[model samples]
Target: MAEDIEEHEEDTPTGRKKGLLIGLVLAVVLGGGGFYAAFSGLLPIGASATHAPAPSHNADEVAFVALDPLVISLGPDRGNRHLKFAAQLEVEPHATASVSHLKPRVLDVLNSYLRAVSINELEDPSSLIRLRAQMLRRIQIVTGEGQVRDLLVTEFVLN
Candidate 1:
């Protein structure tokens, strides 16, 4: 009976030690995995981290000039589809006057370019980026390089 008790006591301690070791290993593994996921941006909280805003090289020297909204009728066979585009031109604070002076030419270029686009092209989901680039290029050409910084498309509606 004494030998049986001794054996039982030994078994209990060894089993508890084994269980503790396994728990410690599990904790370590889980902790490491969580850290890795966070660091790698795989976790939702980590993934939500945003990039720091880019430092302004010109230091508040940027200005926006709102362009007149354009309403252009799509080409024939579209059955009265019209595209309304509203945008702003980003320019140097000092060049807002110069950029605004070219507004008529800018509007003319935009009108012609938009009119020339096929209805199908305007309907494509991926065409906005391309159209923006094209429009920016055209505006820069009219306003002269460096006079216009960027073209921000605020609204585009097709009906």
Candidate 2:
């Protein structure tokens, strides 16, 4: 009985020797892999044509800026000869170059798009979400692929 108890004790996990060895080996392999991946640039950095990061701004700061409102005149049939809808847009700070280069194009697309939208679409609350996506696509198209990161509508009011 004594001999059997001694054998059982020896067989049971009594120390951190194996665990420590495994941990060290795992750490070494993982660290080496990470270093190689980073230094070799094996990890995907991204496409060369990718847009720059958007400028970080607190919600308060964004809200503080009184943006110039865009009044798009949707042609008749909804009401009078002209129906006016309001829109606001946001561009990433890093995208300044792309935005500046394609400002005219952005404005043209925005105007045309707004002009074509039905009154009902403009009036719906959730419509702004859909409109933002549309505007983002249009802006990207105008600015060239991967130019604009996003479009934020600070204000979307139809009057």
Number of the top candidate by TM-score?
1
For residues 1-159, what per-residue lDDT tens digits would candidate 1 score against the true structure?
A: 999999999999999999999999999999999999887768744433443255565758879999999999885678988999999998989899999999999999999999998888899856777798899999999999889988889989999
lDDT of each: 0.88, 0.64
TM-score of each: 0.63, 0.50
Q: Which stretches of candidate 1 lie over 4 Å from their true place?
A: 1-59
The stretch of ten residues in a row with the least summed lDDT in candidate 1 is 44-53
Record all residue pairs in model 2 with backbone atoms less than 3 Å apart, i.e. clashing: none
Error of 1 at 70 (Å): 0.6
The model with the greatest lDDT is: 1
Per-model tally of clashing residue pairs: 0, 0
RMSD of each: 10.2, 13.6
